[model samples]
Target: MPHKRAKRSIRDAETAKKGHNLAPQASTYDDTPRSASRIFNAHAVQSAFRKAGRITSEDTGERKPKPSSSTNTSSSSSSSKLKPQNGSSSSTTPTTKQTDPKKPAIPSILPNESLGEYNRRVEEFLRPGVSKAIKEAASIKAAEEAAFRREKKDRKKRTRIERLVKLGKMPQAALDELDKEMKNKAGKRKRGDEDEGSGSDDNDDDGDKTTTKPREREEKSFKPIEAPRRLNDIVQAPPSLPHLRKLGQEKKVGKGVYGAVGKGSGKDPLNAGQRRILEEERERVVKMYRDMKAAREEAKVEEKGAKVKVKV
Candidate 1:
């Protein structure tokens, strides 16, 4: 319990006995009534955390223990205090009313044993397994909750991806590209592991040689996509100079070119849709170019009219 409420409180005097009430509160007459603290529902708090037992007033230290002696307190000067004094030197025989023993309200529901004795016996019986069960239950619940959170997080990510796809922010090609990149990375990692195990320095030296090669350098290299300066540089440049020929591709052997060969076409070799997709993409580019040209012409005409108006 928190130190604040552990001390005897006003509720102890007020609720201790049926015939009792708290002694007349002693305070400065100038004291205005303080706003009462908001009362919270204990059960609600308990349920929020999925606690097994209901929270009682005792749990919050709000309710003090009921007096063990089930008798009325005598009117005395010490009684004016908030709590009854403990370990008093003067002991008096507490007065009791002569009455017949009351029958048990629960009938056969309660065990035919005293509370202290029965509790001790039952605890001795179940003590061996109860603690282990409680710990296991807590661990299992934590694991389940952790799994549920992971599942929820993944579901949220999937939903976000789906929304992006619907909004056209994420293309299907982007997903495929990511999958291909992941596969490539996995393959590269596996190859690296194999290289480490086999003690292969030859491939490493070859990579270093390739990087050092002057022809592969970019500064003086030509790009195939770039328009030729003289329009016929494609055939004018010597085949021996790879940079001047086609930027990169050089058919030194086989049916495939060198640049395309290194890249593995990276595309699906068995794909039948590549031709269809390329045709559709070409058509889309042409249409887009026409629309852009029309827009530029329209904007130029508008600008000319605005300038003519300003001159006038």
Candidate 2:
């Protein structure tokens, strides 16, 4: 049992040592050999750094570094080794670098031959179809403009016709004739008057005498017609109503009525019989109005002028 226990203790110590060597350790400020080894190993543990380099190479494929002859040789060898399994290879050859011209030449104001050729090509590409479209559009626009002008002219003509119609003038068909006649008559009359004024003495005297004879004849033929007198003028005075006077009263009469002293006399406007008849007539008028109202209510009649239709 002692021997077995001693062996087991030796095995545990060896296992612990291996674990200590393999496990990651926290870093601290120390330069001990063990710590130094730990730091070195930590840096060295980036074994996949080659993958990052390859990824960079893949991303920037075939880009040549500055080609010193020495570098060229080394890169050629390295590139050959790193050649892709897909049979693709990166170039190690140096590219010829173009130096920018010392002064950039000023562009010509006029197009160069190449620019002219390019322009011609573009124009040739668009010419047939674009020109046809443009012409068709212009033609349509012209037609529309012409139609608009025609419509405008027609509208003006219609307005002129309407104006003439309203003024009770000749219709459009006769307007030109009427205008021409009026112009001709005005011209003729003006010329005739001018001739009459500027004619030789004998002709002017004859013209004046002829015009004066017509004036004399017109005055001689004129006769005034008598106008009938108005009824108001003929009467001259307003008619008077019958006088009413009260008993024992003397009253001066006016145009309308007299005092109550004349009442019931033969000369009174209303004698006793006439006064009774007037009272009966007043009652009849009142009864008639009442009967008319009752008849309207019985017939369920509304007032005649109440309802009216309104236009919206």
Candidate 3:
């Protein structure tokens, strides 16, 4: 409760004459205490923490006590405040509710039991459950972490494969094999789910008819798949150097080959399709050069024939 100051009273109320001048000054402020400071017990502290979810009841080994005589008095005062005259309920006595038999009653603190003994008893009552919960939580977290790492690795590998494919490094056969593996895995998962469903149904029926024996479960073997060889490995290409020129610098033509344009690492080879396209482009360039040479020779021959005609 907050401390409230006493209200000031009129200084000369009794001696005041009609129309007499009243004292302009009021009384000084009073500093008297209103309510005593609250005292906290360990049990009350534990109960507060429990209610606030900061600690479990088993951790403190204390149970909340039922409302005492003080609460009853407070209830009576509240009932008086909400009287029938104030349009409240007319019942004078509070009703007693029946306890459910299915619900377990809280273990009461023994009169002779110390706090330490109560804590020990609580620990004894809760140890098994707490340990089991801890183990399950730890195992679940470990499995989740392992799964996350595996997924991260797989994602990195997939991205690497995609990057190589874009750079014309991976072979067509490798891509085909990867697609086939994915399809087979999907099919296997669907079949496995169906099999498990049927097996569970059969087990349930057999259990109903007779006692079922515990079956030893076989561990599934996990084999790591080997990554396919890069196309460059099959068709060796000349080692290309990286571009060493800085930005904004003019590229010198007819000087030296700077680097291969749009090509990734020199070690990574081009796919068969790219190689074929390069071969076709080379053949076309050669054919165009030969035609130009033949045309230049014919022009020279026509100039000579005109010179001979003029001489005759």
Candidate 4:
């Protein structure tokens, strides 16, 4: 009986201790609130509030109620101020002006204005010199023409004189007279010769007979003699005295005879000094010849002496 009582007391003490631990735990849990919303789905709750009109969507087109008339008046006043600033800048900065399309940009200068002025200035600068040169040239040409004409006249006169001299047709005095007469009669003689045809009948008959003669006889009769032969023959003949006088102002030899000497000689001619030198040289040559002859004779004598000695 004592053992059963001890066991029942132990079981009762264990049941009380268990009740004490459960009561505190049940009170702490019961005292805390059940949160009612999730922490992670906060955006979904906020979107639901927005759709319900509790939150406003400013950027999106979920139309909010329109603003009052006072707000619109303030915005219009700001825009009008900005428009005046742009208009003032456009008015102050000017546009570039257009140029004329038809006209060329470079200007033209006239030839008559520039070139004419240059030509006039050049002419003024050179006029005096050019005129002086022209005058000098004219004077020189006139002098040349006058000289040419004088030379021609002198040559003609000389030829006429020489022809007359060769023909033995004129003395000095007669030559001057004949020249004047010929000058006067020249036109008349030319006309007469043209009209004469063959010449007078008697002259023609004589000419025919002359032509029929041997050509050699005709040539011999008319041909000029060589100067040397003429001088030698004429110098010896006495008939040349009158002819020598007609040579006038010419140096004469042996009274009215022209001695041929120097340039005038028919054979060898000499000036006074040349003639003297020649005579001296000739004398020296003759002396040399005599000396040579004497030397040859001496040599011949020496040879004969050598031959006699050899014989001995």
Q: For this target, which candidate reaches the highest lDDT against the unseen true structure?
A: 3
| Model 4 lDDT at residue 113 | 57
How well is each residue in 16-100 modelled by candidate 4, as lDDT tens digits? 8776555444343443334544545677988898788763434342432333345677775553432312334434422322246
In candidate 2, what are the lDDT values of residues 179-290, reduced to their tens digit?
5665686688669867865776667669856765444544466578889878675666899989778899955554445443354443656579989999999999999999
For each candidate, the alpha-carbon lDDT, in order, equals 0.62, 0.64, 0.67, 0.64
Where in model 1 is the C-alpha error above 4 Å? 1-119, 173-312
Model 3 lDDT, full chain set: 0.67
The TM-score that candidate 3 achieves is 0.29
lDDT, candidate 3, residue 58?
61
**Between which residue pairs do clashes occur in model 4?**
none
Q: Candidate 3: which stretches are off by over 4 Å?
A: 1-106, 176-312
For residue 181, give model 2's deviation from the true position in Å.
29
User: By lDDT, is 1 or 2 better?
Assistant: 2
User: How far off is residue 218 in model 2, in Å?
Assistant: 83
Clashes of 1: 0
RMSD of every prediction = 34.9, 33.6, 27.8, 47.6
TM-score of each: 0.20, 0.21, 0.29, 0.20
